[model samples]
Target: MQTAAAVTQKKLKRNVSLAFFAAAVVFSLWYINFSFSEFIGGIPIFMNFLFTDFLPPKASDLPTYFGPVLDTLAYGVVATVLASVIGLVFGFLMARQTTPHPVIRTVMRGFISLLRNIPFLVWASILVVIFGVGSMPGIFSLILFGSGFLARVYAEAIEEIDSHATEALDAMGAGYLQKIKHAIIPQFVPGYISWTLFMFELSIRASAILGLVGAGGIGSQIKLTMDLFQYNRTSTVICILIVMILVIEFMTKRIRERLI
Candidate 1:
């Protein structure tokens, strides 16, 4: 009877706490600087941009975009390839189970964390200075981001695998390479492909934005048109880009589904 009473008291306390927290959130939302009024005030501006600025898109710019489109696709392909290779190496090295060395794993983890957190823009800026402004900087930045992301994913995937499989490989007098090739790689193939696909998707967006820094791609054309107040051309360019991205995504999805 005493224990039952205690449980009821704890439940009541938790309910009261949650109720207060919910009330506080409701009050904050109603009175905060980020209230719906802020969005309401911007509706007119959004309407003007959508109705006045984006209508009658200049479809004439489509022809001129072929080269830039190809360049962007090429950039994504190259960056994804490089990132997959680098990420695999780093991921394997960083995996605690794979490394089995405290210091080395710590260092690798730190490096991955650093690369993951730093924005691609910052890397692009640094690369621009060193590589002297071109597609290369964009490619390098994509490589950095993609590699970091894939490395983390790969490492986590490795950590989730069956320890027995690894032990079996080890019992056969297998070295690290042999254990990975026989035990790890086969199981990792699907996850590796998935990560590569995701990185390719990310690289596509990164490649598009690289043109903002003169990294050379379709983004440069959009930037130039927007700077000149050629809104129609910019709108048309975005439309084309959307269609291209959708097509690529569709094709990739089909392939991945088949493969998986």
Candidate 2:
């Protein structure tokens, strides 16, 4: 049904977009001082450091890391739950259909965007200065980061819901609260759960390094070990982090598969 001119124009637009994407990649590499030759030259040295210094992970240190690692897991779980609750409220405000006013929606969108743009490390640093070096800063950092991301995801999921359901409720003389309770909440549950699980997985990884900024977690252990040239202990910590991440990823994938 499409005309030849339309097809040609579409192809031209696609090519232009690809060109711009390639240009952006090149620019980013240059801006970051990425060098293929340097990377190749450093491969041997990197391998030597990895094998000689970090090899034979100190299994004995496993017991030492248990407490901090548990702290990291707790941070991830608590942050994920807090963020989901906050994001759920903000998400309704962000969604086009659910938002009460255009101005409020726009403002909420901008605030969420700002939260997403700022790195968790930056948040941790600022909060650490305010809260004074503890798990509180790290927890708040994950909450801020996860809430912003999940809000956007939740907004999109809300937007994609079948409009007819809301319309039918409206026709039935349903109040806004009733319509949302019956229609939106039911439809958004699966997507919200999936996104929440994904965010929890990410928070686990983030919490691991949060301690380096004095926010408290396994990252402090990593930093301390590295500073003392105790690479073997650091390697053990790294292994635990890798295993934790892998397990979370696997569990989330299976859960999502079942839910979705």
Error of 1 at 231 (Å): 1.0
**Candidate 1 per-residue C-alpha lDDT over 1-260 given as tens digits, one digit per residue, 9 for 90 to 100:** 56988999999999999999999998887786565776998999988987798777887657888998898889989989999999998898888778757798889999999998998888888888899878889899989988999999999888777788889988889898888888988888878887788888777777657778877777777788889998888888788778878887887788789887
Candidate 1 at residue 27, lDDT? Answer: 85
The regions of model 1 sitting more than 4 angstroms off are 1-38
How do the residues 128-219 of candidate 2 rate in per-residue lDDT, one tens digit apiece?
99999888999999999889999999999999999999999999899988988998999999999899999999898897678789788888
Predict model 2's lDDT versus the native: 0.92
State TM-scores per candidate.
Answer: 0.83, 0.86
The C-alpha lDDT values of all candidates are 0.84, 0.92
lDDT of 2 at 109: 99
